[model samples]
Every structure is written in C-alpha cells, then in structure tokens.
Target chain A: MTVNATILSKPQVKNAGKLLAVLAAAALLFAAFLLANGADPLAIYSNMISSTLFTPYGIGEVLIKSTPLILIAVGTCISAKAGLVNVGGEGQFAIGALFSTAAGLSIGDSLPSFMGIVVMMLAGVFGGAIWSGVAGILKIRANMNETLTTLIMNYIAYQIVSYFVFNDLKDPDSFNWPQTAKIAHSLRLPRIAGKINLGILIALAAAVIVWLLVRKTKWGYSLRIVGGNANAALHAGINVEMVQIVAMLLSGALAGLAGAIEIAGVEERLRQTTGVNYGYLGFLAAWMAWNDPAVAVLTAAVIGFLSVSGNVLEISSGLPSSAISILMAIVLFAILWKGKGRKSE
Target chain B: MILESLLAGAVQSGTSVLLTVCGETVSERAGVINLGTEGCMAVGALFAYIVCAETGQPFLAIPVACIAGGLMGLLHAYFVISRKANQLATGLTLMFLGLGLTAFLGRNYVSVSTEGFTKLRIPFLADIPIIGDALFDQDPITYLSYLICAGMCLLLYKTRFGLILRATGEDENVVYAYGADPIRMRYLSVIMGGMLSALGGAQLSIAYTHTWIEGMTGSRGVIGVALVCIAAWNPAKAFIGAYIFGAAQALQMILQQQGLEISSFLLMMIPYVLVLIALFAASIKKNGKMPAELKKVFEAV
Candidate 1:
C-alpha cells in the first residue's frame, strides 16, 4: 500500500482507533500465551469475568483489592502530574503500616472504634509523608534522581519491616510466625457488604480530594506549571523546588494511607507479604489512567478485578498468578507505543 | 588468613556486578539508560540455569543467556530509539515484563541443580601472596570479566567506533552529520549491554551459586546500573566501585556468619543504602560528566 493512500483522520478518531487496536492486540497475545500453557483461553476469560463480576463475594473481593490500589494510584497521579515519578509507593506503604500498627497497638483500646481507625490512618499519613520526604529532600537539594533513590528505598523499607517483624513487632504468643499482633477490633475498618469495608469509601474520597486539589487550587496550578516547564515556572515566580517536594510528600502520604487501609481493612496485622506488589500495581493503574485522579480510581477497580481473576485462574487452570503481570505489561506496552505515535503527530 | 579469604570472597561476589556495570557503561555511553537491567538479569539467570541444568554445559549457557537478554534489549531499543517512547517508562515496563515472563516460565526450574563452572588457578600467579590468591584463582567467568573490563576500556577510549558511540550520546546530530546512523549505534550498544548483563546473570547462577531460583538475581542488576553512575560512566572506575560493593556484600555475609549482634535484615540493607548514598553524592556534583543525551532522559521526566 502507498503511504500517501492512507486516510488521514481526526485526532479523536485516530486515538480511539489506536486504543481499540491495542486492546485487540493485547487480548490476542494473552490468548496465545494461555494456549501455549495448555489452558483454554475462552474458558479462562469467561471464568475470570464470571468469577470477578458475576459473583457477590467475588465483587466484594474486587472492591476490597481496589481500595489500596485506588489510594496508591491517586497518590501516583499527583506525582506524575508534577513530572516526578514516584516508585517508592511500596516503601511509603510499608512505613505507613508500621506507624499505623504502632499507633493502633498503643491507643486502639482506649478510643472508640471509629476514632481509633481515624487515628491509625492519620498516623499512616504521617509515616508515609516522612518516608517520601527523604526522597523529596534528596531530589530538591541534592538534585538526585528520585526514581532510582525511591526504588532503593523500597528494598530498605522491606528490610526495616522484616527487622521489626522478626524482632520488635513479633507477637509474643504467636507460634514462630513472623507477624505482628492483630490490631484491636475497634481499630479495624468495619465491613459493609461481604468482605468489603469502609476502606473503599476512603479511597474514593481520596480520589475526589486529589481531583479537587489538582483542578481548583493555586498550588495545583503552580504544580502543573512546574511540571510542564520548570524554567517557565521559575520565571513566573513559582518556587519549583518547594512544589516538587510537596508533590512528593503528598504522593507518599497517599501510598501510606493505602498501606494503612490494607492493614485495617484486610490483614488486620502486618505480615511479610502485606502490600505485596500493590505499589507496582498502583503505579500501573495510575499510568493506565494517564495520571488522571478520577480515571485512576476506575482503572484501579478494573485491575483489581483482573488480579482476583488471576487468583481464580491459578486455582482452576493451574496458571501462575504471574499471568496477571504479563497482561499488565502488555497493556502498558501498547499504551506506551500508542503514546509515541501521538507525540510524533 | 581471614582478611585474605574476605578479599577472595569479595572478588568472587563482585564479578557478576562488574560485568553488568561494564554493559551499562556501554549503553549509557550510547545515551540509553536501561532501568530494566534487573529484569534482564532475572531472565538471563533463569535461562542460564535451565540451560546448564539440561545440557550439563555451563559454557553453552552463556550464549543462551545473552540471546535472552539481547532480545529484551532489542525490545527496549525499539521503543526508546525507534518509537521515541519515554526511556525510563519503557525500561520500567520491560523490567516488569522480564520478571513476569521469567517467573512464569521458570516455575519448574526452581530447586534444580547444575554442574556449574569450577575454579581455575593461574600457575605462578596463584602461588603469589594474599592478593594473588584473591585475584588469580577464580572461576572461568571471573577471568572472562577481567578481560571484558580491560577490553571495554580499550574499545571505548582507543577506537574509532567508540568515538562515534560517545558522539551519539553527546550529540546525535553530530553522529548524523558524520554520516553514521545514531539510531543504529544506539540499538547496537543497547543490545551489547544486554548481552553483557545476561553474562553477569549467568555467572551468578552457573559459576557462583550453582542453582536455579526465581528472581535469583535480585537487585544486583540495579546495583550494576547504579555503579555505572558512581563510576562516572568510566569502565575502569566501575571496577573499583563494583569491588567496593562486593566487599560490602562479603562483609555483610561475614558479619552474619560471625554472629554479630546486627540483624540479618539490617545487614541486607547495606548495598542498597550504599547505592543511595553514592547516587546522592554523584548528584551533588554538577552535571559536568554526564552525557548530554542521558541528562535529557532524567530531566525530561
């Protein structure tokens, strides 16, 4: 086919076409992967849909999983908008859990149930903020690459948690398991339906607040300006460094809150596997939303559904849970490739 | 005697990271920052371990590992060079892809054993003092790494192609003006880097550890990338940085074995913490030595 014979289309139409094409390609690729592994693609796909969307308990699990993801994605959206890539969500989340657990263990018995939960969340926010602030300070003052530092910080965070669990936080009565004592029932988030809890509502509220913070405030405007062009923002008398630092802080606080919610809502105690892969999953969700707060919440829910389905696939078809990662990677690749096309245009 | 053994262990541990740093130096010199080095190593380790297990040929595993890693690099290059996608994002995505793919395919390989490369001693050199034993007596891959390091330095500083590669990193337009395709150079360098990184992973499994485990490379890939920066993109300096890091790792293991009061978890944090500190120090200095194109990748985000 001649290049000149190709039809030129409107930007919106072209974008829509690209999206559909990418989705089709990703679906086909995933099907091939499943087929290679001796599983029936059609059956797996239908099972995933039925189990995640059709069943009541499955739906509740989706909402439950989406809580931390939504919160973390909203946080990631803030940083992405500010042109800062925050990969330290895992570390921030872990620290938040650490602080929240400490706070819960101390005053949870004294306060009313709702108040205790609030106190734990607040503690989580503080913990996350401080953990992220380290990277922010390094970036702002030292001109260090936050991406690399944030990633390294994640390993450090894991070690810190491991240290605490193995020594300081290990439940005295527990039989050799490396976990902290379960939080008091008063500190736990109350379930609304099936296994779903108040954490989902909190995550939704966070999304709305972030949307407002980005759309309706002077600080948000300055952040956008800095993100768009640091030199231009500086010329316009904005404190670019301060904006970046604050954005990182806010981003980290959200991730921390995700960690807190996960503990209070599901696990009720900090364990080694607590917050496993949630940070990266949230990062993927934020990117899938193109860093839009409102869209991120929706994307988080979709990914959460898929993740739960991955579990079902493992049990039913013996497919590895890592299959979800392959799916996520394909989606990301397609979007990234499509984005490149848009930029050239 | 204790000091001599520690030094010997440090050299052994550093060999894998040293190879990766050498690879990263080449890629960065060609203006590509591959954050997916960790993922590449994971896939490489799995491939090498599996190949060694099945074929009982440790040497054959190296080429297989390189091919696996080279494919990953080609994917990264397609996005970063051909499509002009964001380098950092593409790297991160590739990392996830590598990890996911390896974990899925390597499920059956875990707990398997292999006939890994055994140590070889240089005749007179091995008989020398403490330093000789540490440096001259090593596995085949470790000896290969020393050659690779020296060869890399010579290739980068003393060759015409090396000049062109460096020019591509500093100014793609200059390379274009010189009638060379900068994009092609970038792709080649990135692929070469991937091959070297895969070799490092192969060494980790086939020469050092001798067993297959999922995610066995851990964050060594990342440490290698960081060491490239700490070395100021110099292959020779990367040698020192790699050894220092390896020494730290060896020290940690020694401390644990000695039953030091420090928590093992805290000890595990050493190399990562060092990377963070080194990165901060590097950043504090003005951006005098960083390739202009590489700076753009970090600044663009």
Candidate 2:
C-alpha cells in the first residue's frame, strides 16, 4: 500500500493497545468516582455494559442517538479543520429544528412525502447556516470572539425556540403545552427497522462525503493551509476570511441537517428541549476523534453508548443522569493526558 | 427613583461578574485561557452553598469555595502545562466536568436553604445620596469585590510579582531567561483566577440568591471571560464592563416589574445580547492591546 493509504488506515497494533490501556485506566478512575459516590461500581458498570450491548432495543437507541452525533461531529470536523471552534452547534441545531418545523408546518399535506421532506431538510440547513453565519460574520467583520458569541447565541436560540413553542407553534389540539404540532405522517423518515430510521445511513453517508471532501478537494487544501497559519494562507493569495466563513457555514449546515433529521426521524415534533446537549456531545465526539470524520463515526457511537448508559446509571445506581458526564470528562482527560507528550514534542 | 434603584441594583448584581473578570484577567495575562471559569464558578457555588448550609456561616464558605476552585484550576494547569493538552479542549472538558459533577453532587442540596450574608449598610454611607446606596450599602462580599478589583490592578501593574507574571504571559522563554519559573507562575495565576471566580460564585449563592440551585451561575462565568476580553484584559475596565452587564440584567427585572408585557424569554436575552453588542463595540474601538499570549490563544482559534 501507498504510504498515504497506510497512514489513512487505523492505528498500528501497538498504538491500538496503548489506546485500550488508556481507556482501561479511564474506566478505573470512573469506577473510583462511583465508589466514592456510594454506588457499587462493579454492578453499575456491569449493568451499563449488559443493557446497552445485550438488548436489541438498546442497540437501536444507540444507533438513533449516534445518528445526530455523527452528523454534527462531521460538521464540527469541518470547522475544526479550518481552525475555528463551533461550540454554537447547540444553538444552530435548535434553530435548524425551528426552521424545519416551520417549513413542515407550512407545507403540511400539500406536497408529496419526498418533496416535503426535501424542503424541510433544506429549510433546516439554511436555518443552521444563518444561525452560525452570525458568528462567522462577527469573526470576520467585528473580530469578535466567536466562542463567546456562539455560546451566548445558544441561550438566545433556546429562548427563541421557547417563545415560538409557547405562542405560534403551540399545538392547538393539545392542552396548551409548549410544543409544535406533530408534522404530517408522510413527512416522517421511513423506519428501516425497530426504532431505527434512514437517519443512520444518512449520517454515515454524510460522514463519508465529508471525509472525501476534506481529504481530496481543493477547498480542503486551502482549509488546511488556513488552519495551519492564516497569515501564510493570505500570503499565498487565498481569501482567508472567505474560506473560514465558508467552513463555518458548511459546519452549521451539517448541524442543521442533524436537527432536521432528529425532528423527522426521532422527536417528530418541536419542543424547546428538543435536541438538548446534542451539540455539545457532538462537539466532544469530534474532539475525541481528533476531528477526523472516519474516526468520528466510532467516537460518536462511543459517546452515544455512554449517554445511553447515563440513563441506565440513573435507573440502577440511583445516580443523577449527569453523573455520566463525569465519566465522559474523565475519559477525555485520560485521552488528553495520554496524547500529551506526542503533540508537545 | 428608577435610576437610583437601577444603579444600586447594578452594583449588587455586578459583584459576581466583577470578581470572575478580575480572576480571568490574571489567568489570561499569564497566558492560559481557563474557559472552565464557568466550571470553577459552578463548583465554587455548590461547595460554598454546602458549607454555608452545614455551618450556617456564609463567611466560612468563602475559603472552602476558594480551595475547591483552586483544585479545578490545578487540574486544568496539569492538563495544559504538564500534560501539554490543548487549552481550549482542556477548559471545555473542565467546564463539563464542573457542571456534571455539581449536578451530581448538588442534586440533594437543590431545595436546601441557608442564612446567607446580609447587606451591611455603612452608617454614614447609608445616609448619603444615590451613589452611597449604590456603592456602600451592600453585602460584605460585594464590598470585597471592589477591593479585589483594585488589588488585582495593583498586583498586575504595580508590583514586581505582577511584572514577572505579565512578562511570563507575554513570553515564557524570556521569563525563563531571567531565571524565573514560568510554569509555576502560570499555575499560581490560574489557581488565583479559580479562587476569585469561586468567590464570585460564593457571592452569588450565599449573598445574592441565598439558596443552592443547580446551574445557578447561568453562564455568568462565561460573561466574565467575555468582559475580560472587552476590557482588554485590564482589571479596572472589567469593573465597568461588569456593571454594564449588571445594568442590563437589572433593566430586565425593572421592565418586568413595570408590567411592560414583554416576553420573559426576550427579556432574558438582554444581558447576553448586550455582551454581543459590547464585544462588537470593543472590537471596533480597539479597546486595548490583548496580552501577547492571550492574543495567540485567540488567533489559534
């Protein structure tokens, strides 16, 4: 195999072994945390593993959760490659859901199922693009900190969604609950098996496409150059600002698609709480995978499993579901700790 | 009367953000952006609330909260300085760790109440006009916040230790050449930042809110980070910046009280939107030179 092809493959046996060792260390640390919290680590860990891996329904739920995570992570990779952090994925996702739902509501039963779904997805994409575009524009024009702007906007977007749900989007048939009416039946994604829909496939396909684009395209080359050193890219006659902005837009668009798919494929209605924390989780998944789309698929699944296990921890160990984040953070810390010397040197 | 109440309310609410901004200014000047300041604040608030609830002494919670926040800072320092992890990633993870850990540990303390610090109105100052009520007749923590800001300014600009700290942030190698330890300086600065941020959180819970609540800081730590940037990393400017945010929050409440019929959600966005506007204005005006290392961190994106 070519050197590039070999490099593109998974890590060698030794590296894989080291990764496993690191993961094992993280698991041990997490066990200590559970023990300190008065939970039986062995039982909790066993329950987490058995329930998530042993049941078909659990597997289906894992895939469903991973679907958005995969899509959002792929999008996160695009922005990370361009040397930007899109932590606003949460806000963008919320806005995307709002936009898609608005479009779905407007086009209710008027068009064929395929056409309606396409329109909704398109609306979602534009909605996310616009939401993230604000930060991108601020970065270029005002030189504002995108991280803070994006974070603040996440709250603003949530409030906006809440306002709509409580007012214009409130389900009239229901008793004043803050949620939009369910979309037309035809607008829902076709279920492939059990709780699984076509979303997983779509997410995987998007990941592959992103991987190819980032690896092979001219824009990808420019993105790498810009990310490496914007000054150097500017010296090379590249429009650094434009490239970064496009990356932001594309990243947000993908996140928006995740929001839309979530609405059609999972929630089937819009609520203020729809897709909560998915953005942050997806961003973490991308970071865990080091922003590589191919590796992101695996990382997304790992995050999804841990997230599902968080719910299990709540049920079995009587721990708050948020207890899972401690585990997640510890695992990430271990990874960062392990990868340290290599990057610094 | 409205203006008087508004200014007084601004001082009351601004204390927490002011403390955090000062802490962050010190940390960032030492060349590390602890995006986990939010986490530190959250952890601090919880620990402080716990201490206050258990002991019925809000003052005792301050030191405990500082220690708790310092531990978080040490963790971030270990990852960024010793392990050489990415600062942004480390900080974000620290934030999640803080949030999740607080939610986990604080679940039982949700409904607990404590005898928090009450405003200690200065006798002469209380009789003065609007400014006295705004500045002097306040909780001890709020008063301490003003001194902390001044002390931070002096520490960053007027002292030998401050010079070394600022020098370390600008160029670590240069400081190393001078026979100083940049690593230790960064750790100290970060820990100090964490302590101050925690103190802010303590003020929020034991003085302002008087009750333990999950996610109570409400991203105020982030606002602290933003204010630091807008202040151009100057502690003094951050004082003003914090009050501006506090006024925005105060305006929201004032408007709601007046029966203006605005949506609560829209009103809730005011402080955040004001941050965006302030950032825009600061960027346009070229407010101040960001610390050399801090600039690199931002440009690193």
Candidate 3:
C-alpha cells in the first residue's frame, strides 16, 4: 500500500511549526503596540479584519494591490532561480509603466479603443524585457555584477520617468500639479466579476506559464540545472549564459507586465512615486517563499493584508505610517530568524 | 562666468560623492554590501539637522550625526551579519527604516535657521590656479574624504589588520581558522562604514545645503553601490569612480541652472550611462575580484 510521506518529511513539518510559532510572536508584538498606544487593541484589530473583507471596496483594493505584487514576485523568482539577482525589478517595472503610459498618451487618437489597451500592455512587456535584458546581456558578455548593474539602472529609469512625466508628457491645459493626461478608459485593463481586475487573472495565469517553463519544459530544466550547479550544468552543455539571459529577459518582461497591469487596472496614469516600494515588497515575498513561485502569491497577499491593516491602525490610533514599516521589519526579521532554526549540513 | 561657476559645482559633486565612495570601498573590502548607505546618510543628515537645530551648536552636528549613523550601522550589522539575515534585504530594510524614521522624526527640523559649515581652502593651494581652487577650496568634509581615501589605501594594503579583514572577506570560514573572530571584524567594519556613510550624508546637509531635507540622499546611496562595481574592488579605483559620477551629477545640476540646456535629463542619465559601460567592462573580465564567499552566500531574497 502506498503511504503518505508525512512521516518521511520530518524536517519540512518542523520548519513549518517553527515558522508558525515565530509568526505568533509577531502577532503578540502587534497586540502590545496597540496597548502601548492606549487604544482598544481588540477593537482596532477587529475593525481592520472586518474592514478588509466585510466591505466590497476593501476587498477590491487588496486584489488591486495584490495584482502587481504577484506579477513582480513571479518574475523575481524566475531570475533568482537562474542564479541572477535582478534588483532592477523596480526599474523594469517603472519602464514598463512608463512605456505603456507613453503608448497610451501618444496614440490617444490613433487606435481603436480595444486595440490601444492591447498595444499599451505589449509595449510595457517589451520595454521591461529589453530594459532587464540589457543587464542580462552584460552579465553574459562582460561578466558584470548583475546586482550592481541592475541597482544602478534603477536611477536611470527613475530620472527618465521623472523627465517624461514632468516635462514632455505634462498636460499643458490641466490646472493641477505635475501629472500626465489621464489614460483613456479604453486603454485600462477591464475588471473581472466587477471586483477583481483582469490584471489579477493575468498574473495568476502568468504564474502557471512560468511554473511550466521552469518545471515542464526542456529549457526550464536546463536553466534550473544550471542554477543548481553552474559548473556542472556548464559541463553538461547547457549554455549557462544563454539560460541566464533568457531567464532575466523573461523575468523583466513579467515585472514590466506587473507595472502595466497596475496602470490598466488601478491608477491609469504614471506618477513619480508610481509604486516603487512594491518592488521591495515583491522582493521580500519572493525571498520569504524561498523563490517558490506558487508561495509568492500567498506572501504577496499577506503583505497586502498587513499594509491594509496597518493603514487602518494608523488612522484610528494616530500612530505614524512608519510604525507599520517597523512592524514589517520585525515580521521580516522574525521570518528570516525562524528560517535559520535547525540548520542542516 | 557661469562656466566657471558650473566648474566649481562640478568640483563640489566630486568631493561629496567621494565621501560616500570612500565609505563603500571600506565595506565592500570586507565583502559586505552595505545597501544601507543611503539610509545611513539620510539618518545622518536628519540628526545633523536636528542636533544643530537644537542647542544652537551647529558645529557639533557633524560629529553627532556621524555617531548616530554609526549606531544605525550597528543596528544593521546586528540584524544582517549578526542574525545572519540576507544582506540585500537588510540593506533594503535599513533604507526603508531610515527613510520613514527620518521623515517622521525630522519633519520639524527641516526649516530651522542655522549657519552651516563654510568652505575653506588650503591657503597656498587656493591661490595657485583654477584647478587647484576648484579642487582644494572646499569644506572640511572634502578634505576629510581625501584623508579617508589615503587612509583606506594604507589600511587595506599596509596594516596587518587590513590583511586580516581582507582575508576575512575572502573566506570567513578560512579566516575563522585564525584566532580573530570574523563576527567581530564584520561588526567593526560595517559600523565604521556606516559612520563614514553618515558623514557623507551629513556633508550634504551641513556643507552643501546648510539644512537637511527628507529624501536628500537622492541617488547618492545607489551611486555609492555602483562605485564599487566600477572600481572593480579597488579603493583607489573606487575614488576615481566616485569623481566620474560626481562630475556627471554636477554637470546635470549646472545644466539645469543653465536652463535645462542639453537635456538635463540626459545629464541625470550620466552616472547610469557610465555605469552601463563599466558593467559591460566588468562582465568581460571573467576572473573579476568578488569576495571569496560574500559574507552571506545567498542574499536570502
């Protein structure tokens, strides 16, 4: 008789248990924070929990936030698995959003409504892929540190976006501060089921695509083999450089898609702060999940929940928004510390 | 006349960026990527502004900021190296922590009336020529940066401790074979690097603006990271990398002042363009020097 492997996988069980305990400790810290502020800890907690799910808009907002996070993290896992650190996810994401916005604004009068949206989304993906591929190419050809190259590329992306938004793309007739013309609704990503947008659906589907690429396909197998052991994979004739470059390009494209989805689904135009920190959050999620693609979705949702809950607490308790960031740091440290429980040789 | 003024601004950028590069060079030498340099700089600027704003002792601001910055570094090292957390995550966290903490705490410290550090020159050198005045006639931080560069050269090459630290960066496990503790050496290296980075951050607030602003570190922190790559793990070369970036940044600011001529955004793209070329070069050199085993083998996420 075939038996379940529950008894055999002892270490995985223990790791899970240990992590659960650490998370419980963090929850206790959250309770303490509420008490220290002289507010009703239970009430705020209940309120945040209720607000997130009880209201339709709150649920929608969480999905909206989760959409981009999922896209970015999945892409992050791809590059990370290929043994490349693509910290330029932020830059790639921004460029995707920027190019998408540019496509929308420039072709505002030219294309049919449905076609414009498709065009914009494609532009974003290509823009992000190429942007990230530059670093990937450098790593392959020049032996550059992808980490440094990607990190530096972020500033270039930021500056160019800043220029486009503030100078060239500025809506001259608009009476408001520095911002672009609102992207036509025709170009926005449509919402599905009147709640979750097409973006979330796209992100979920993309994850499946990536999972297949990394697990089922021959190229995916080669990339993973190389990532697991570069020298060994190289000897086996899996062009390590080719795998890395392809993985990075794919990763960057996904990251860019995430940005485009954010624009299409939520904020229709790009802003300077057009969600930079989301990249960091995605980075965190990917890391916490140990680069596991499926787990990234859950981690992104958890981060979204914490942030949404933190916002509720901030408004009701008069605590600074930064307190949430502090809690995030605590939670992050707790997860990482917990990960170190009972190291193996 | 504007050209000379622009040239002078360029000099300022070189010196200021130098402060950060010198700090990063030391950290990378120990094989730790101190991504918190921007945050440390921001914290330093914030405290420098706050300390000076209080007690009317503007002069004490730099030292105070440096110490506070060192403490922040201590916190970073405690979490990342001590707890064995991922370096990139720790650095990013430090960045967010510094960004939020500085903004929240130093909101009130921004617009206070204060006299800042005045630019001083090496007396004889200041009189000699245009280049000399541009380079030598600057605030004390620039001079301090020069000393730091020289000091880095001596410490990394000449001293026994330097050799040990370098050896530690290459392979802590091997270094562990020796009597010295890798942990302690890392703590010391990271902390010192933090202090120096804070000084670099404080220099902008104290010497340049004479006041602190939230998010003042701008691209400087990221620039510091890029400098290590361009320098190819040599402190001396890192110094050169810093100046090149400084020139790019300074040129951008000058061009903006000159009416955004030549596309100031293009100017903004300067460091990035240089870095792209540098990365291409670095990637070509297959056996480029990366610390034997970066303190943390995996950046954890």
Candidate 4:
C-alpha cells in the first residue's frame, strides 16, 4: 500500500509544485505592476486574501460567483476537446437566460417547483444549443472561422436581449428599467446556506458528469479522435463534422445552463447586464485548467476568489476593481508561457 | 445631404479600421494572427491621450502610441514564437492585459480633455460636389491613411520584401529552406501589425474623439480582425471592407438622428451582423484567398 501510494503521489506532487511556481512568478510580476502604479502590493495582497478566504460571507460570495464560471468552464472543456474553440459563451449565456426567463414568466406557480426547474433547465439547454449551432453549421458548411463568427454573434446576442428586455419584457413597475419581471418564488432554486443556493451543486454535478463522459464514454473517444486530426478521423470512418457540431452544441448548452441557473437561482429576472464577461472569465478558467473538466472546478474557484477580492482591493488599496483583471491576465500569461510544448496544438 | 455625410462619415470613421486591418493583413500574410490588436489599440489610445495631455502635441502622441503598441506585440511574439503558446489564447490574454492595465493606469485620464489633430481640407477638392467633399476634405490623418493603403498595397505586391513575407505566410519551412529567417520575419510582421493597430487607436483618440475614455476603441480592433477575412488578406481589399463597416456605423448614427422609431440597440447590431453575413458569403464563395499557414490556425476545411 505504501509503495503504491508513492507512485500515485509523485506526479501529483510534481504538478502541484509547478503550479505553485508559476503562480509565484505571476504574483511577483503583478506586485511590480502594483508598485509601478503607486499602490502597496503587500497590503493589497493581505487584504484580498484575508477578506476573501477568512470570512464566511466572502467565501459564500466566492462560491456564488464561481457557480456560473464552473458551469461555463466545464462547457468550454467539451468544445475544446472537440478541437472547437467556443468563444461564444457570453452570447450563449445571454440567449439561455432570455429563453429560461420567458419560460419562468409563463410557468410561474403553474407547476411544481421541481417540474418547473427541470423545464427551465431544458429550455436553457435548448437555447444555448441553438445559439452555438449556428456557428457550428457555419464552420462545417460555410467554412467560416468559428472564433470570429462566435465573437460577432456575441454582440448580436447582447443586442437581441436588449431589444427584448427594454421593450417586450420591461418590468412595468420598475419605471422603464430594462429587465424582465421577477419569477415566482417557487421557481427560484432553493438555498442551502446563507444566500448560497443549489446552483453550486448543479455546477459541480455537471463537472463530474462531463469528466466521466469525456474519460469513459465512446462518444468522448470519437471526439478526441476527431480533435486529434479531422482528416485521419474521416479516413478512419468517424463522422468528424457531426461530432464537432454536436460538441459545439453541448458546449453552448452548458453555457446556457449557467445562464438559466443565474436567472432561476440568483438573479430571478433577466437584465441586460446579466452574465456580462462571465463567458470570457470562464473561458480563461477553462484554459488555465488546460481544458480539463475536473481541473476547471478548482480554477473556477481560484478565479472566483480573485473576483470577490477585487472589491477588497478597491477598498483597501484605492485601486480600481479592474486592477484584479491585470493580475488574472498575468497569471494566465505565466501559465501559457511555462506550459509550452506540453501540447502541440 | 445625408448621403454626402454618410460617405464622408465612412471615410472619417473607417480610417481607424482601415489602418488596423492593413496592419493585421500584413501580419496574417506573414503566417501570424495577432488577436492582441485590440489590446495594442487600447494601450495606444491611452498613451496617446496621456501624451497629448502632457506635451500638448498630438503629432508626438502618434509615435509614442506606436512604440507602446510595438512593445505589446513584442510580448505576444515572445510567447508565440519563442514559447510556442497558442496564438489565439495568448492574444486574448494580451487583450485583457492591455484593457486592464489601461483601465488601471487611465484612472486619472478619464474624461481628461486634450488638444487633438486639426482637420485639413484640401483647398480645391473641398469646394467640389459630394464626392470631392466626402473623399478629400478631412483630417490630415485621414489623408495619411489613404497614402498608407496605397503604400501597404505597394509593399505587399510591388516589392521583394512582400514576396518573402507572403512566402513566409505560405510555409515557414519553405522560407527557411530558401535561407530566409522566417522567425525574424514573423517578429517584424507581428510588430508592424501591433504598431499599426496602435496608430489606429491614436487616430481614434487623438484625431477622432479628442478625449480619453475607457474602452473607447469599442470592438474596432476585433472588427479589424474580421475584416481581414473579407479583405482576402489583401491590403487594398481591406480598405473597401473597412469602409463598408464604417458605412454601417454611419447608418446607425443617421437612423438614430432621424429618430426612426427603431430601437437603437437593433441598429447597433448592424455592423456585427453584417460581418457575420459577409463571412458566410465569403466562405460559401470559397475564394480560397487565406494564407496557407494561417489556414492551419482555423479549423481544417
């Protein structure tokens, strides 16, 4: 048992050490940035760490913020595995929220909470799938670059949401505010702790399920084969286009599910600003984890901590909350620089 | 009257995208796509604003902005060429870095007023009818952009350097085998791309808006990237593509001014939607004009 433990622990330890080293380098670089800007890095770092991890409220906020990130990162992993880069998570999330909000408004208190939640989830999934489906089809049929197309679609989606919320779905009682009506209480996701709802659990379950699907399923094998080389997969009788399209749909569906949960589990209404930049932040998390679904969970949490502490940095150091973005980018750069030659693609 | 202004607006606003697309076209032609164009532009705008505010010289701000942008490109090149990082991911990181760093550093410059470029109207051309006014009467930078387009066209097609650059884009190994330093060529191209992108941002802040605002570049960098495809990786075609986008922006403004009852949000989406349609159209036609090595960066078709 001892001999077996050493074999398993060795690689895990080495990987952990590398991660720590990279993180230290990034932290040092970011500290210099802070110093250059006339802020004291040591005080800001301590304030951020203590306020974020040492307080229960802060921990809850971190978990809450990470719920959508975990969902989106796991979804990104699926598309990344299929050799598809789905940068449309922001658009997918918006469309998903739009769909689920419409459903929640109509089904309010008409069905049991359990049944209503399931329907919203499905609605979110369908919305997200359709959103990414266009980009996938364009890639397959039109030979359009998915990266640029999806990004373009993101702006269009935001406008679509704005058109709806500011007109058709505008809350009548809110004096022209661009937001949908709040859903019935029964439709909201039940909370497990202080303001921390079941969204985190759903996000976690989705991660585990995706990890299993990618590692253990036949479809996953085919997806990986296609990702490795489309021409080779085609020659080997794999339906490469169909596999990639499905992967794109699944990826978008997960992002949409995050939107649905944000509406049902947290926001309770759709707003124009709902889930803004969450997609890119989640994409960053996924990339940081090297597109591993399991690792995305931890990375999402780390990002969540940074985001929550952004407020603390602002309060303690007189720096803008956006300063945290610089640190996050530095961390990603360090990982990208140090993680060279690990994967050929 | 609206048509005249629309054409004139296209020339005015399109200059920024034109400069950026030209730069990106050259980079993509050299077998590297700098997604950090937006980041470079952001940094350029901020630095340009700072320089104009401090030194009171809009002209001096241009070179300062270019240097800042080139440094950003250098960082991207080091990661992509030396460390072999994923181009798209590194570019996005660079984007966030530029945006975040600018936002952090630009706190003081927000809403700060600065002296900017004065418009220059060509003497006789400005007196002509619609076409002359729309085409010839504008900022000095706008006139410079016309020259830039022509210069870039000549550099890409009429020069030996252009041949080597295009060859590098097609296949770096082939260029290497022919005894050319492909890596150095890529570095130069990417740096040039970054500098030009910053120049566009400088035009935007110093010549166009004449004030500092966070994220003022506003997806123009990404729009420039998208236009490269429609341009077929050619600098001349990029001018036409960029003006079309500019025309869309002008249309949005015109419609809004007319109080056309259409939601401004819908109109705001025109440029993006148009890009999507153009991309689809271009792809379906299968012009097959993309750089060979750049083709590997996108999904295999």
In order of DockQ, best first, we have: 2, 1, 4, 3
* Regions more than 4 Å wrong, model 3: A1-13, A24-46, A107-114, A193-195, A340-345, B1-7, B260-263, B282-288, B295-301
lDDT of 4 by residue, A1-345 (tens): 998898568766786678789889999998998899798999989988988899888888999999999999999988888888888899999999999998999999999999999899889988988999999999998888888988888889999999989998888998888899999899999999998999999999999999999889999998888887888999999999999999999999999999999999999999999998888888878877878899899999998888888888889888787788788888889888876323433
Alpha-carbon local distance difference test for all models: 0.86, 0.88, 0.78, 0.88
TM-score of chain A of each: 0.92, 0.93, 0.92, 0.93
- Tens digits of lDDT, candidate 3, B63-116: 898898899889878877768777887787788778777876776676785666
Candidate closer to the true structure by DockQ (higher is better), 2 or 4: 2
List where candidate 2 sits over 4 angstroms from the true fold.
A1-11, A340-345, B299-301
What's the lDDT for residue A139 in model 1? 87
Model 1: CAPRI class? medium
Q: Score the docking of each candidate (DockQ).
A: 0.65, 0.71, 0.48, 0.65
Assess every candidate by TM-score: 0.95, 0.96, 0.92, 0.96
Report the CA-based lDDT of candidate 1 relative to the real structure.
0.86
Task: Name the best candidate (by lDDT).
Answer: 2
Give one digit per residue, the lDDT tens place, for model 3 in A73-130. Answer: 8898898888888888889999999988888888875788779888888988998998
TM value for model 4: 0.96
* Model 1 lDDT per residue over B140-206, tens place: 9999999999999999999999999999999999999999999999999999888888888888888
